[model samples]
Target: MFAARPYEDVLMDDIAQQAGVSRALLYRHFPSKHALFAAVYQQAADRLLAETKLDPTDSLVGQLVQGMDIHLDYFVANRHAVLAANRVLAGDPVIQTIMTGELDALRARLLAVLPLADESARRTVSAVLKSWLVFVQILVVDWLTEQTCSRTELRDICVGAVLGALRPLLPADLVPNWPQLAAGRAGA
Candidate 1:
């Protein structure tokens, strides 16, 4: 119910009716409509993290592509919920924390896969990953609203973007042969 309809349109009474429970029982569990929305959004975030399987054998690019595909799939399917969470409840700390937690977990996975030279590199790459994740969130949320580009193009742009952001932070030796960079160099 929350995923399909705008958050403002989803009443506690309706949620209770859909769940085959009375308003009393629903309030006992969630307390309020905002609380209910938070629970649903948290479940979605947890499921996304679980589904984004990162194969250690795959290259960084491959892993990013896989992650983006999974996320994009969710975003497309739950556009209304995502928009409500991002726009309607933008000021909600609980909602923001869920978003941050998911992004931080993703950053840790990316840091694990990066070929960093030392603690300094790890820290630098972690910062870059943090910013890139936020960038993706904003861009993708905007895309959900306007759909200015194809889903595949959006995914590719996200993957390409993080790669571009990380290129400067990584060691010089690692940059030249990085998959997309290599392809780009050949063309240049």
Candidate 2:
């Protein structure tokens, strides 16, 4: 309903009617519309993370590809929901805190997988990976709305960009196979 209607017009009564529940019941669960929106946003984020199931045993590049695929798939599937969430969360401090915390957790998990030689290197690699991921996400959103390229083609572009950006930070052996794996993804 949030996606279908303007946020200001999506009242508790609208949600209650849509859900076939009483307004009182809905309010009992979510004190305000903002709370309900936040809940939905958090649920979507959690669902996206759960669907990815990043494997620790996989190579870093492989894991990154899988993660990006999952992220792109989610955005493609739930573009409106994502847009609604973003709209509702814009300029909201509580939502911003929640998003930041979730991202920090994701960063910690990714940092665990990267083989950094020292604390400084680990921090540098983590920052680079975080920035790369954000860039890829923006690209994915643009691709989702534009549909200028097929998912396979977009995946190849993303993989290439990610691998190129990480070449200096990643192991030498891993860097060489990045392009090969990306190119061969259609076959696999």
Candidate 3:
């Protein structure tokens, strides 16, 4: 129900009917609509994170591309839910916490796979990634609404942005080859 309709337009009774459960049971589990949305959003986040595998065998670029693709797929599918979380529930603490947790988990996964110079470099790169992820959220959310560019272009833009931001910070030898970056995404 949350995925198919705008947050404001969805009613508790409708959700109960859709679930084939009594309104009393629905309210028992999730006291309110906001609570239900939060739970659903968290479940979606968990699924996305699980699907985006950060394998050590793959190139960093490949993992990045895969992660972005999985997320973009979800964002495109659940457009309304995302808008509600990012716009309508933007100020809500629970929703914000869920977003923060997902970002932190992703950052941790990237850090695990990233070729950092040392602990100092890891710290710096972590901070940079934090900023980059937040930028991605804001930009992608806006893109969902306005759609100023193609999805492929938007994906490339995000991939390019992070690579650009990390280029100067990363050691030369540690950096992935840029020329062939886009040509072979899965192997890159």
The most accurate candidate by TM-score is: 3
- Structure candidate 2, residue pairs in collision: none
Give the least accurate 10-residue stretch of model 3, judged by summed lDDT.
179-188
Better of 2 and 3 by lDDT: 3
Q: Kindly report which residue stretches of model 3 are placed more than 4 angstroms away from their true locations once superposed.
A: 177-180, 183-188
Rank by TM-score (best first): 3, 1, 2
Model 1 alpha-carbon drift over 4 Å, by segment: 171-188
Per-candidate count of clashing residue pairs (backbone under 3 Å): 0, 0, 0
lDDT of 3 by residue, 19-61 (tens): 9999999999999999999999999999988998899888767
lDDT of each residue in 87-182, candidate 2, tens digit only: 545578867666666666667778887677899888887887677666775676677568889887887787787678778877887565666776
lDDT of 3: 0.89
**Model 3 vs. true fold: TM:** 0.93
lDDT of 1 at 47: 99
With a 3 Å backbone cut-off (N, CA, C), the pairs that clash in candidate 1 are none
lDDT of 2: 0.74
lDDT: which is higher, 1 or 2? 1
